[model samples]
Target: MDSFPPALLAFNLLLYLFTYVAATDSLTAQDPYLKDGFSLVSSNGNFELGFFSPGLSRDRYLGIWFKNRRGPTSVWVANRNTPINDSSGVLVMNITTGNLTLYSHDSTAIVWSARLLRKIPNGVLQLLDTGNLVLRDRKDENPLNYSWQSFDYPTDTLLPGMKLGWDLRNNINRRLDAWKNPNDPSPGNLSWRMELHEYPESVMWKGSQEYFRHGPWNGVRVTSRPLGIAPILNFNFVSNEDEVYYQYSVPNKSHTVMVVMNQSNYLRIMYLWSATERQWRLYTSLPRDFCDNYALCGPYGYCDIRVTPSCKCLEGFKPRSPDSWTAGEFADGCERNKLINCGDEVGFAPLNQLKLPDTKRTWVNKSMDLEECKQKCLSNCSCMAYANTNISGSGSGCALWIGDLIDLKLIPDAGQDLYVKMLASELVKRGEVQKTDRLKPKMKISLAVIAPSLGLAILFIGLYIFKKRSTVKDDHEKIEAQDLELPLFDLSLINSATNNFSIDNKLGEGGFGPVYKLDIVFGKHRANGLGAEGQTNIFEALE
Candidate 1:
């Protein structure tokens, strides 16, 4: 090879150095990001913004992704829907329009552009440590007052500090749209957004239909289910005239967490980065089980995962179609066994540890107490159920459901209470049944003690009667044997002997009366006796 001149070699080296500087530096109105290895890296070196291809596809698109990760894990895509066929893509800030625009270098054709309402004269684009690609004025340091930010237009994943809700003042609704597939970054049919109603709720949608619902905020959390305190994480929700949004943050920056809406399985999953495992660990997921399905048990019926059938009618309610319910079809829901007369006495039966029902046709009073809520519900005949709006501290506020209660579930350790309205007769019957249920265990214990005592008493009485009869029989037998053993005397002989010797025989008075001596022999025995009047007495001394 021929050696280059000294000056030419030095010039070539300087040109290469300039290119390197352009590739790594932040973007400004004067510097355009070229697809030729040019990227804007966050100050902390945690994130990078540039043009890249996803999966096996050769198409190029501008996106922001984690820099330290093993592979390309894109967090946000700018031109996901539009792909550049070649490596001629350029991301440039238009100074005149105050917009960030992506264009094809060869044809100079615009692929995508950020639409801004007001023009910014001194705009600077920078990627932040929080994975946010922001466009702001050169003079402003406040991130909240940014001209344009990727956080406001989430693609799929919700990183810490990203708001997923509405900016009422700007009329912008921030939502998450899942990717079409792992390889394709285009928006998918599945999405998650906030449903604004009298009581706002976070809802996941499969196209236009509601797929899953996170029950309305009850002052503490977004859903009715309690999410215990996570020392590393903090969740926030704001609802006022200016905005209504929900966001989460990691207090410990060392720990990373993100929520992803998985399109393949139609699931909203939360993941925590594990430093020891070097992988994202699944923390939890939404639509947690079959019971989490929206309105799976229909109106007036609640789903319980702990039960076999899962679906059950609320108190004072019966299946609308018994046959259908038995066959596992619960869409028909349930009906009040005894219809309530609006003018008659009624009561509220409380169902504990439950996910509050839907609030489409509902009313709320932030300052009202639970008792006041009950009276308000009773005044409105259409009201089906009521619950506390806020359950923090001594629970405050009131929320009443006016129509049929829908999408109820039993979330055992982590849910609120819902009081359902019922007629006086039905309440009385329910109270009686509840009373019986409470007494069942006590009744069992009482029977266990009394039954054995009664049996022992009956057994002792029977033994006493048997012993008395046995003693009487034995005495009678003894007397009969003694009488048989005694010898018999001839009454006629005794009478003649006593009459012939009456006065003479009375020689001496005895204790028995006038006595006389008599002698008799029978067989081998001889007897001596004393006769008095018409009787004879025998003595052992004479014998």
Candidate 2:
């Protein structure tokens, strides 16, 4: 090539570098470089990637989100902290060095990059069906050799198949950080993480300080957030002696799900294109009502949304400050009506639709039975409450809380049941037997009346059908003289005639009646079944 000016030569070299990167695996790949652009698509083509500006922010950020989503929401943001000022952001993976980097107008100025511990001999960045953007070595064909993955660092949104804990061996911990605002992709002060310590529980941190806690793994849910435990959001514990990690996934393939913490620290789960509503629907949320705020009613208090006054003191417990409680200030919590003497006569209080307390100062035994858990809690004077850790089985294991029970909520269904340890003297103080008889008899009486009524209905229905069928021959003869003869089609004949009532035939009657109307013969001639005087079945006539 002919010698050129130094500046022009440098510009040409930069152009060649961009062109080469923009060409390699630039289309139909997980991470595609589109000439001057780039896209990250899931393996099953469920999602796509491009430059997105969250909300009203003009700053451009690279993100991957559902392709045909009802609402375009970025699930993962690459340059969240350092957004490009304009639409000129380019993402490319260097083929030789296996380094994936985002660029601004200046080719050498790196905007964001996946800091890899080691270089992959033949690496390629791929977006998996799980919504994880992973860097894999092509030649190795081993999943264990993944150099880096987007799952390790989550923005606000928690996608279907992302882990949320630490792998101490590899130093990878997938954690979620709230966004600065609705439109800004920058990390917010509130961070949500699965604490691998003690046991896996989702912990919310306001900076370095732990603000709220989702209690330890109860085999069903985090005790403090029983509502967060859902079928759509399947929690998983990855451990095998050496290390432990926690993650979640959406079991249904047809369902598009995501959990996002808005700027206000409200975690919301949304579903896409629900069958019942035929639109995107918000399934559930945390801090949904006032009760969700961590320990709104302080120690020894429970939040019951059903009551006019949702916050209430546990049985036999009185508010520390009666004046404050009446004025809607419950930070003083509640004091026991009678102090526990650790006597042999202590009992447990059954609380329904209540989320279990926090687990930070709690004790757990994964193998202890519910009864054993109860006994354990009773033995400890400080243990305020106890619950079965695994509700899936015969309620195996124990979770006992000794400190203040925080973030209690009233969930509709699937709320963890907590047995509050109370002194036997408290039962006498509250007049337990008097209240039990008042409430228990109504439920029993209602069931007793309902069960017999249902049985009587079934018996009456059977007798009526029997009597009618027994007199069918006599009724048929009586009607023959006055009623017209009607052709009764066989089930198979109707099925074959209408092709099993295919949807095509199910709608719109043709000018000649139904589209698949067929002629039927009785004996040797085609029969006109309509009588001169008899009426049609009113139901079919209305149809």
Candidate 3:
């Protein structure tokens, strides 16, 4: 041995290490090394792990993925932050120390390792059907008594049994982060995490900017997500002195499911196995539109995708930055029409058919009823709104919004109701404003029926009410245009006004289509100033 060269000796030691790691075919303590030629397959054969490359990238990585899935479906990577340069990588575990380590081919470099906290010496490493790589005591045989597991450390994808939250005892924050891009499994800036503050809630962030939020769990569902279709499975959120985390389970064990943070964007996409298609089918997707953005409509503003301008100041509110709104930017949000009187002077304005606002600033009481929630909110000057946290069992529990309401969106026919605090004076203002808007079209149609003299009177009648308020003029015009869609004019009226488009009323044609002139009169005078010989130009509708 003394005669052997130092380089040759090192080479011989590396050969022994490689040969020792590759001794076993099954994934266990006896079998330390898993090479490219073989894989560590789950008990049910739903997943496999080995050296593999994603997309067309030349780099090989140690990762775990669905056995049947295709096209970059790896859920967890042992070497995510660090990539292996070649296929010369092997996964190994020390049976004595109970440390799962992956090394480079030559056995010279340690790539990644599972440094578990509690080391139970005699343990076996096995991949379970739930896609968890665990270290179990060879004698105990109970999974719960395992020393460690890979489920606690996740990458971009969340399998059915995996969690997305925190482990308080170990002070570890479990989160789901997206991949850098389609071809790379490296961690990206976008992440979906739980903010365990005053009220725990799920938030999606791109860098520091919030992209989407799942309002506090109400024991039934995410208040931010209205259940359009009944759920097929159950979602669980557990919080105690020991731990706080979110996880989901399927009703049937036969069905396979996964939730992935999509590579192209910051949306969470849910996929399920489709036997017919032989691939993962999109079960559902989140943050579907601008309304889904975290606090997208801003403070005191509401979003409705059905309307042209999605963002609008809630009733009894005005845009804080009119210029920002004019430019189609709404992050600055809206201001209250009247300052809060505080205490009992303020009244609760029930906002129905809308997604609840942010819950980080909310205060929750599990034992209170809706009425108790109302009384509690009404008594506190800081409380801006309140709602039943859980809508089950006569809606027990209270969730009070103590600050500005953010990320409110109308959910068409269904949604959670929010009773927002408002000045008693403005409580009737919203109803009055809505009533006025509804009557405007009727008023305009009725006013259009009258002669010229009364038309100004009707327009003045419509103008004075909103003009007195501090609401911006441009916003009012836009609102009118949006809410008032039809002019309610009949074809016969146009035909009558044009005098059946006589040759005398005919006008020159333009590049778009044809143009025509018309003369119209009302009962006593011209209709809105169509005088004795007044000419009205009717142009063809341009495409």
Query: What CA RMSD would you report for each candidate?
Result: 13.4, 29.7, 23.5
How many angstroms is residue 406 displaced in model 3 relative to the true structure, after the best TM-score fit? 1.2
Instruction: Give one digit per residue, the lDDT tens place, for model 2 in 241-301.
Output: 5446566676777777777766564454544556566556777665456676667788888
- Model 2, position 55: C-alpha lDDT score: 79
Which lDDT values do the candidates have, in the order given?
0.82, 0.70, 0.77
Most lDDT-accurate candidate: 1
Q: Model 1, which residues run further than 4 Å from truth?
A: 1-25, 30-36, 224-232, 442-543
Return the clash pairs for model 2, or none. 295-407
Q: Write the number of the candidate with greater TM-score, choosing between 1 and 3.
A: 1
Could you estimate the TM-score for every candidate? 0.79, 0.67, 0.72
lDDT of 1 at 404: 91
Compare the candidates by TM-score and give the number of the best one: 1
lDDT (C-alpha) at residue 523 in model 2: 41
User: Candidate 3: where is the Cα deviation over 4 Å?
Assistant: 1-26, 141-143, 430-543
In model 1, which range of ten residues has the least summed lDDT? Answer: 533-542
Ordered list by lDDT, greatest first: 1, 3, 2
